[model samples]
Target: MPGPIWTSPAPPGNPAARRAPPAGRFRSWWNSCCKGRAEPSRHTGGIVAPERVDFYVLNQADDASRLGYACMIAAKAWRQGHRVYMQVDTPGEAEALDRMLWEYQAASFIPHARTGTPEAALSPVLIGTECAPEKWRGMLVSLTRALPEGAAECRRVADLIADSQDHRAAGRERFRAYRAMGVEPGTHEIRL
Candidate 1:
């Protein structure tokens, strides 16, 4: 089993709970209609704005470690009423993500098309996109930097996967050459 990513929970208890209940009495009520758009200004006065939280999971192949981190981030974001999205390049990648989301019990999975080609899958991938009025980018930067050893682990796993793909490609090329020469490609022998 893996440990959690974020340490603490959202503050002020419940976000919705912090909202000021409808003002009581006719004086507070009397303020409405008499003033120009007072209700909208009062509600939108930046006093009770929703805290913005966004989690972006970058491009990933079959590496479960990266997905696990994403799951943790997503779970935290969901708890805070923030929108969560994942960028999936392929059906297989999307399915792997589905399994990760299932494991983490995230609120939702939104698929997105990756800009690069399949070959790019072996490279480092950035997943999530954060947009908010204040410090959202800074938050993401800090979160990524704070990734205890996640980036290193993710890089190692990605390297192993890329190496395997290269090996498979080389084997396919060798087999093709054999077929071109009208000879059997033959099976590979494994030694103990």
Candidate 2:
């Protein structure tokens, strides 16, 4: 059995409340995630880069719940025959994600890396205190070795992490440029 990484957020002694696991919380999250946002309309837009599927998580009231949703979405996409890239902060978190992915019988694990020192191209999706890439590699290797099977599947998880890193880098660039241009934050209407 996997060790527990989460605590329920429901108030104690609430008989009417459902004590839902991580997956259950995803339902409410997917709904309010973009509340009051304009729905992007369909148009005859020219062929552009394959639309990158994204789930933006600023912070989570329930971290496990958020992670559960992220794992589910990526697994679903993989089932649909799309390549997936998953990223999580720690090896333990990655283990949880790997378990979820394996439940779907996707690919096995492989190293997801770029050439040069790991630090030179370390994943940006890895948030919090700085750790050498070697340390990361060691943790990941140890965790995957303990798995019963599905090494390739772990690679898919890593791919999603890479995707998150790419997304984060793009966001940083946009924000930096926006600040440099002295554009006031918030949506603006322009008659282009």
Candidate 3:
């Protein structure tokens, strides 16, 4: 079950065209074809394309506060003409965010739908546990502890870190992860 024997090809005008190919001259064509191809490195493909990550570390320990802040960021991004993708920890969180999007701003609401829904394709903002779709390549507001799987696609990422000790630890881990991915994350203290 070996690949085809790769006979060396000669130029049309070369007199060597009639000569037999030498031993080892039949090297695997596949290997030569793939030579110099770079592979994804240990550091998330070694930051194949560096990303701009900003960590928003809130002063409050309440989980709801983090989500609320995420709502604000998503809304702002939507208004700025950027497609926003909200990455949550669970479907429960996605639902909660969907509800908050309607009430967070009181008079106005950020139009958004869950990841798989058809409306998500047209909406400026999308919320879900899954990775952001290829088209939704704007800012990704992450509410999860670990980095979102589709983070590499987004040009900018906003990671909300709650003030609790556990949340802080998780945030630190994510910080290191982004660094490993070739991005130096910026930290901003959120007072609200």
Best by lDDT: 3
- Whole-model Cα lDDT per candidate? 0.33, 0.32, 0.76
Candidate 3, which segments miss by more than 4 Å at Cα?
1-46
Q: Rank the candidates by TM-score, best first.
A: 3, 2, 1
Error of 2 at 165 (Å): 20
- 85-182, model 1: which lDDT tens digit per residue? 34433456556655666555445543322223452243222233222112121112112221212211110111111113544454455345433433
What are the TM-scores, per candidate, against the unseen true structure? 0.27, 0.29, 0.74
* Candidate of highest TM-score: 3
**Which residue segments of model 1 deviate by more than 4 Å?**
1-62, 105-192
For 120-139, candidate 2 gives per-residue lDDT tens digits of: 24432222112223222211
Off by over 4 Å in 2: 1-53, 58-60, 102-192
Over all chains combined, what TM-score does candidate 2 have?
Answer: 0.29
Give the Cα error of residue 29 in candidate 3, in Å: 47
Residue 22 CA displacement from its true place in model 2, Å: 40
Judge candidate 3 against the unseen true structure and give its global Cα lDDT, from 0 to 1: 0.76
